[model samples]
Each structure stands twice: as structure tokens, then as C-alpha cells.
Target: MTEQDVREVLNGRRAQAARNDGAILDAARTVFLAEPDAPIGAVARAAGVGISALYRRYPSKEALLATLCLDGLRQFVTIAESAREVPDPWEAFVEFLRGIVDADVHSLTVHLAGRFTPTPEHRDLAVRAGALAAEILHRAQQAGVVRNDVEITDLPMIYEQLAAIRLGDATRLRELRRRYLDVHLAGLRTAATSYGAMTGSAPTRAEAGARWNRTT
Candidate 1:
């Protein structure tokens, strides 16, 4: 083949491969969200691509899952980073928590993060997101908007408890989460200090995982 012809052919192949990769990742996200243990073949079918093509893009199901998890982590980091821009610290903190729960309600990655050991990249991204969340929490506490006793770690458990409720209807579930979220937000305020003694200890990661897994 002529040099120009060969270059054109290579470019076309690269474009096609990129498209296939995108489709496979999109399909994997949808399939895994519905069933975390879904097979590679199901993802291939969902993506409308051949199994060989999917395998070419992602050698294994785990690899595909890692990509999905990484993407979700990036999105979470974005939300937390954006929260920092809000003028009010308390509002920023509340919105950050809201973003996490809303994303968790729609995507499986956040839930998976709780269930499985994170990859190094996933862990790093999560830590970055957590740092941003911690900053927001600290700002709120310093402002005396949020209760002094509340720790950053408490936020995840609150989200977990709120997300654990599953109404069969989508509309009802959305409303329920929103209503309970408002209640939880209100309780987090400093003025809501009428409650009795608080527990000093929080659940370990393993304990939290076990509790959530039981509910699932």
C-alpha cells in the first residue's frame, strides 16, 4: 500500500477502536449498576458489540469495572471541588453530602466502593474527595453552623442509612430520600442540640460494610 493510504487506514482503525471502547464502558456501567456481578457477555450484548471486541478493549470484566469505578470517583471529586466555591460553608457542606447521596442513588460505583477493596487509583481519588468534604465540614463547624460533635466520618454513615431505604417506585424513593435528607440536614445544625448523650465510637470500615451488606 502507498504511504498515504496506509496512514488513512490506520487513522480509521484508531477512530473505530475508540468508539468501541466508549460503547463498551457505557454498557458496562449500565449492566453493572443493575447487577454488580453481571457477566462480560451481557455487557458485550448490551453494548451491541461482539464479545471479542469487548475483550479487545477491556481484557477482563474486572478491568472494565475498574474503569467505571475510576470514572465515578472522578465525578465525585468534581462535585466536592465545586462545593468549595459556594459562598456559605454550611450550604457547601450540605450540598456536597447531597451530591454524594444523589450519585450513589443513581450509580453503582459508590455502593461498590463500600463493598469492595478499592484499587490504588480509586483509593487516591476517594481520599482527594474526602479531603474536600472534610474541609467543608471543618468550615461549617468553625462557623458554628454544624454541630461541634459531628465528625467527617459521620457523613458516610448518614448517607448509607439514607440510601438504604428502597421504595419500589422511583418517584416515591426520590421523594423519600429528599425528605429524610432534609430531616438529617436539620438535625446536623447546631441548634438541634437537644438530643441526649452521643456515642464516641464510629463503626469500623468492616463493621459498616457488614451492616450495609446485611441490608442488601
Candidate 2:
């Protein structure tokens, strides 16, 4: 290769190392959110980086707060992806709703979202996901299955509420989950069920394997 190309490659590696800063921040979210009182050294260890490196990147605890705000946008993509339909559009919305409600399992993700001022890139990703959800919600509304009043943005807000409830008390979490499902099932329109047979079956391991590339 030309000397210029070699220099470019060397510079790219340096740039990559600088960009790696965000990964450590992401890891920091997992620790800080789980235990806000945890020390910086602990967060550094949790992130698998040296304490000096962590301090060098984030001089103070307060600096990390901004990154947490950006995480909400990232978390919602998983919500949107889960909401997407495979064989049928309606079932996709239901699954998407379920994914959001079940986000109790992703506490770190939720913590990142507690404050929402996502970076521009993250915000754009969120906008794309929201558009997809709006289409699905609109279709469901047209079919008279989903609540007509439920706006697209409401999905994220509602999911946050459910996450809050889910995280609050272990004793109530199970009952709350069951009751939530029961309410969802009760609200289903008779016509919503008509498409059930058309949709056929849940994704199996083989079908999942075939569809893996398509899904990502």
C-alpha cells in the first residue's frame, strides 16, 4: 500500500481508541444506576478499565449524568424492534408492548432512560423507531383493536410507568405482571383474534435461524 494509506490506517486506530470512551461510559451506567452510591473505582472495575483511565475520561461523577440521558433513546430501539411484526402487523404491536412492559429485566437500560436528552444521533434513531411504531399503532387503531387515544409517544411513557412499578417491590412484581397481561387480554377486540389463525405460529429455533439476518 502507499505511504499515505498506511498513515491513514494508523490515524484510524487512534481515532477508534478515542471513540472507545463511550463504551466505558455505557458500562459505567450499569454500575452507577444499579448502585448510585458506588465509588468511581468500583465503576471503573465494573467497566473493566483502570480507575485512572476512568477518571481521565470523566473527571467527576456529575459528568457521567449526561450520558445517562442519552441511553433512553438506545433503549427504545429494542422496544421498537420488539414491537415490529413478522408475519402479521397486529401481533407485532402486541409483542412490542410486551417488550416495553417486560423491560424490568433491563434496569440499567431503564436507568439510562430516566432522563431523556439523547444525543443527536441517538435522537434520530429514536425518531425512526417512533415512526415505525406510529405506523403500527395507526394500523391497529384503524382496525379498532388498540385504543384510539393511545398516541405513539405514549408507548414509551407507559412502558416507563410499568418499569417503575415492576422495580418497586419484588412481592408485587409477579402479581402485577399477571394482572397486566389479564387486562391486555380482556381489552382485545373480537376482530383482533380473527387474524390469530392467519398469523400461524411463534418463531421456532429453525425459523429464527433462517430469519436472523433479516431481523438484524
Candidate 3:
């Protein structure tokens, strides 16, 4: 083939590969979030890609799960960072919470945590995300907008609780989560406007980490 023709073919192949990768990751998120125990074949079917093609990109199901969780962590970090830029402290906190809930990254934490071993990259991202989240929380608390009783550690459980609400219809499920999230957010306001003092201790960092640590 001519050099120009060869170059065109190579470029086409690269574009196709990028598209396939995007499809596979999107499918994995939808399939795994809907059914955490789903087999790799399900993801392949959902992605409209061959099983061999999926395996070529992700050698094992564990690897794919890790990739999905890593993506979720990246999204978490992005949301928190964006919220930190909001001028209003309370708005920043609300934006962070709402963005997280809408992103539904917590669903991965709830359904897929411990399914795959975390890598060093995962730990680093998790630390960054935690720090950003803490900064948002502390800023709101200092502004006397958020209740002081709420701890940074309380957020994981709160998100997980919202993530646990499920329905066959994604739209309905999301609306329900938002409804409950609104109620939860109201309760998270300053004590004068809150229901009462937050009861029970927040989950410790170690306790929260236990969820992500591979059991095996």
C-alpha cells in the first residue's frame, strides 16, 4: 500500500480503538453498577464488543473493576475540586454533595469495593479526594452553614446510603436519591436548623478504608 494510504488506515484503526475503549468502559459502569456480580460476557454484550476485544484491553475482570473504580475516584476528585472554586462556602459544600450524588460514584464504592485490589495510583487519588472533601466540609463548618457535629468521615457512609437506593428505572432511582439527598442535606445544616445533634460516632478512616481493602 502507498505510505499515505497506510497512514490513513493506521489513523482509522486508532480512532476505532478509542471508540471501543469508551464503549467498553461506559458499558462496564452501567452493567456492574446495575449488577455487581455480572460476568465479563455481560459487559462485552453490553458494549457491543467481542469478548476477545474486551479481554485484550482488560486482561481480567479484576483489572476492569479496578479501572472503573479508578475512573470513579477521578470523578470524585474533579467534583470536589470544582466545588472548592465556588465563592459561597455553603454553595461549595452543596455543589460537592450534589455533584457526587449525581455522578453516582458512590454506587461503585457501595457495590464494588474490595472486589479488586487497589493500586498505588488508587491510594494516591483516594488521599487527594479525601483531602479535598475535608477542605470543603471544614470550610462550610467554619462558615456556620454546616453542622459542626458532622465529621469528614461521615460522608462515605452518607453517600453509600444514598447509593443503596435502587430501582429498575435509572431516572426514577435518581429522582428518589435526590429526594432523600435533599432531606439529608437539610438535616446537615447548622444545628439551629437541624433535627438535633448527630447521634453515634462517625465511621473512622480505618473503618472506611476497610470497605476498599481486598478481603482476600
Global local distance difference test of model 1: 0.77
> Across residues 1-216, which tens digit of lDDT does each residue of candidate 3 receive?
999999999999999999999999999998998888899999999999999999999999999999999999999999999999999999999999989998889999988998999999999999999999999999999999998988999988889899888875878988998899898888898964545676789988888899888864
Sorted on TM-score, best first, the list reads 3, 1, 2
Q: Write the per-residue lDDT of candidate 1 for residues 11-49, one digit (tens) a residue.
A: 999999999888988888778777776788999999999
> All candidates' lDDT scores?
0.77, 0.59, 0.92
Report residue 211 deviation for candidate 3 (angstroms).
1.4
* Index of the highest-lDDT prediction: 3
Between the candidate structures 1 and 2, which one is better when assessed by TM-score?
1
> Candidates' TM-scores?
0.78, 0.55, 0.94
- In terms of lDDT, model 3 sits at 0.92
The clash count for each model shown is 0, 1, 0
Better of 2 and 3 by TM-score: 3
Weakest lDDT window of 10 consecutive positions for candidate 1: 207-216
